[model samples]
Target: MAETLSAPALPSVYRQLLDAIDIGIHVINHEGKSIIYNRKMSEIEDMEKEDVLHKNIMDIFLFNKEEESRLLQALNHGEVHHNAKQVYFNFKGQEITTINDTFPLIYEGKRIGAVEIAKDITRLERLTRENARDKQDARFTFDQIIGDSNAIREVVENARRATRTTSSVLISGETGTGKELFAQSIHNGSERASKPFISQNCAALPDSLIEGILFGSVKGAFTGAADHPGLFEQADGGTLMLDEINSLSAPLQAKLLRALQEKSIRRIGDTKNRSVDVRIIATINEDPAVSLEKNRLREDLYYRLSVVSILVPPLRQRKEDIPVLANHFVNKYNKRFQLNVPGIAKGVQQLFQEYDWPGNVRELEHMVEGAMNLIYYDERIDYTHLPVHVRNKFPSYNDISHAPEALVVPNAPPTKPLQEYMEEVEKVYIEQILKRHSGNVTQAADELGLSRQSLQYRLRKYRLNIRHS
Candidate 1:
């Protein structure tokens, strides 16, 4: 069994315990004599603790510092110095970096000695610089963008031009307008193309989470919070895309603006700011002006972020790109579903052009995906193969030129399931056709290209009152 230590050994044991810690620590009395120099300080200074003991801290640390010694300041003023990063050369002339907190030790409101706690980050600083030098390849290039419409071309040209500079970019468009696609293309075409192109949706998380993710969090910042690097640090020397920027609350917008201006971030629990060379590219679904008026976004932040603004034209405005986008998706899904769909029927192409796609390119992709799933090998996607909701957009005469309201779908994807949307459309179309034929079931069936029996079954299925003429 180990022998128990005597009371006289407690002081030595405490001193050894202090020396075992990785950080440098020391205390100074009223006469500026070292009173609590530890082994870590001796190692950091490359001097023996015995030699520094009973000596003024100023005497032991000789440096041509631009700022006054914080320790001396605290000792004289009987004040406190929080975590401030200080840089200096140690006794061996090696550069030392640390964040220190110093305070005058007081008893009964009377100033006594001063204690200093330091966290040495010299090695971490060096490693960070070295890691930043490593190149990260971007995931997107301009060549991958498929649109050639003049509206899309103009936006693309401006985006490309914006990439040549380091100014922040703001992209705005309706849902499914591919804002992130443009952001990725610009990043890939920029001088920082080889650097990481990280993306995050600002609205995806809560306020506290967004703050912690963007600015990072230090150990003990909160419960279960570790010293984790944020997206800003992770995207150093690269681009970081913040999607749905308007979703960030006003207070968070201010914090983001500060980070943009300072190019540095202080973690949730950290005291010192860490510099990062990250380029920002923010995207929002709403117009900046409108968002500002609604107080959903900060005005100053909007101007600071929209240094180079790019507006992605919605699908309706650039309808000319629909065919190409459709074909591209068709080919993509062909390989995915292992089906050899020869091509789209001309009627289907016409129907696609006639329909005003409110869900934009994303909706089109889903439409094609839905159609492809129904078609077998060697089958051509025709108007009938389209989803019922899409087919319902065409009027009784199969003409939508005069039926603007029928072609108008919501900007967002249908909230209900696809089958429900189809049922509603089928019921409405059957009712419209019945009314068009003056309740003549046979004429309506002929016009719909369905057998009379099928028509009767559909009318019964939808509980529609029909007449036979």
Candidate 2:
């Protein structure tokens, strides 16, 4: 009998197959005690197989009370539960994320324990959170204007103060500056906050149409006239933003001047002038002085509307605000997309600082949003995610080159002093930044790492107007 004992059988192929699996796998008995755990499961739990086997499943691996209850319910009811990319903390206190599928294992028409298969997905979760953050930063807000630069602060302070006035305000800046936003903020901060704040693009409509739209017409005043109230009448006791006021036709300009001077408008084919009480905020992209010299604008109208003139600084002028604007845009896009992008890479930040933003804050916003979407895996955005145009402009510090072709250099004598040449370069860069930040100096200053006061000094020295914020 001692010689007839059969040799111990080798492990079955099924057992070997279970042990070979890469994903964590575990089995619990009917009593909810761990019956078997593969190598992967032991690794995931940071324990030896001998330590986990025979231990209560709820007592060993389930960290949270809710998870323990859920596991018990699944085992008792012979149910299956699946969680895709769930987050957890392990025995070592390190955060772990996984996609898990759990199901009751039944045999011989009787409920056995349950088996759970889990795969680590911690990196995926982190990436998702980063994408969300980038979206959150990209949004537009009154606070998006970043600047401690004195010139920019002065403009913001003035704009904030002007919000309390009912006088017709003029916003003068280069294209891409946020003239309309300033107008809107003033309206929002004024007595007409709750009332309708209407906006009209004077450059987009014909003189007759502009006139008709500004002043209500009688039923038979002209073709298609059905006794509609004009924007001015509708906006009575509120605010009206006139965008591109310099583009107004001569005749329309004259009519507009008359209305502002008289504080009333005469409808077409009407003898009576109706008085309306509406605050006017006008925006002109071109320099008012230049427009006056070209005879494109009437001097009287300019003075009337510019009682509180605000000139917005462009992106290049307030380079200090770039980083702030970039961060803001990143946060905005992160929220919108529900991604967890951490922040811009240091290299990308450097590139942003060096590049000339001709398009201003609007351009920067678009670029940040685009980068968030483009960065599929990495939490941090690098220089590669930026638009080619932006990247191209920012030659590496090691690479020396002239400005891009799109950048124009005024013809200056070659014998110009080094300081004068540098000043010109600075002026161009500032102008480009202003255009990028939509003339928001605070935003530009944040990018350049300069105080608003310092930016103001440079602006004055360069004769750059800092009127809009």
Candidate 3:
């Protein structure tokens, strides 16, 4: 009697398991024909598998010759190919991008068909494109911050070095000096770049709310208490920038000091403490030492937070950077509003170099932006474009009673050449313009209907004292 042969049984969940997969999956026979295809694979190809069963895989799909040849070789060699790039042409005549991994199915040491798994990476590709666009839009770098003065350079150098460390940083600067920008740049350059960076203004919140906000409150902890994580908790594994930190109350300052020292926080109305890992970066308009002496800030907390301190110089001290900053703002607004208002005139540059900018760089930026909006095409900004207060503060060219008047030839035959007299007039006018625009060459050029390069040359020729106006 011949021995009876029994057919091998397939696993009960084998088909169900393939169908449940989220990724597209299919099987191809030795002849390169699709033997089985899951619903996802059929949908990805935009075709019904029933109509394409036993069809040549390459014939139904649109793949590069190189990729097709590689897949065929893999099948022939019974080798697995992971993460193969392939393009699939659907019934709708659309090219679908996909990544596939092919593996040969071996049974009893005999080469069978191959299983192919594919995943659509279109969303991931779109996300990458959007990220590139966002980075381009946010292009404020350390170099973009204008200021060649030694004071400003020192501040920038310290900031750059401090960015490399994980210690707490305290940025001290007057309002409008771009303290927040420095903080953001530090966070961007730090190891926690990918992590969340949160900022909170201590002056903006009340004492009661400050406590609940810094150290999150549990449900029913207060009148409107809803359980919520605080900024410290939310910024775990990242940086938390506290603006106007000196504004925090003395008692609340103690709580903050404790949290910093302990690296943990206790929720309001809860005794349990939750560990938190976050870097604290704080900014104060006033000196931390002075704030501590006044009892407005805790000395212990000030020392702890000021491990790395940076003091941004006021704009008046960095007068040389005025022209650079003004030009930057003009270009910014010109592109923003699509205005054709050309460069600042020589007169405006002279005024900018002379004006005492109390608000520093922030004031200069705003003044430039405001002037761009106020001026029109071919119209150079004159003394009138500047704010009345600024113009009134400077001494006019006609009001030089203390100095001896210019010697006139009276009836003497036109002694000095006309060009020399004209040059003298131009020098005086340019000086007035520089005084009017507060040392901003771009603004001065725009006001005088002259190019920045031309005004710069004239300024150097006249040997004018172009520092703070």
Best by lDDT: 1
| Per-residue C-alpha lDDT of model 2 across residues 1-469, encoded as one tens digit per residue | 3544344534555567777889988778888888778888767656788767896654454243434444455688866778745554443334566788888887898877788788877677779878855532212234645667675777787888887779999999877767777777777777777777788888898886888888878888887777778888988888888999988887788888888888898877688989988889999998899999998888888999999999998777888887877877775675567554556766777777777778877788889898988875325676777777776666473233235555656667979998888788778877777777888766775555443434555787888875645
| TM-scores, all models, native as reference | 0.56, 0.55, 0.57
Candidate 2, residue 271: CA error in Å? 2.7
Ranking by TM-score: 3, 1, 2
lDDT of candidates 1 onward, in order: 0.79, 0.74, 0.75
Q: Give the TM-score of candidate 2.
A: 0.55
Q: In terms of TM-score, which candidate is stronger, 1 or 2?
A: 1
User: What is candidate 3's lDDT per residue for 205-258, written digit by digit as tens?
Assistant: 799888888889898887888888998898889889999999988888889999
Candidate 3 stretches with Cα past 4 Å from truth are 1-140, 395-469
Candidate 3: lDDT over CA atoms? 0.75
lDDT for model 1 comes to 0.79
RMSD of each: 31.3, 20.6, 21.4
Q: Which regions of candidate 1 fall more than 4 Å away from where they truly are?
A: 1-138, 395-469
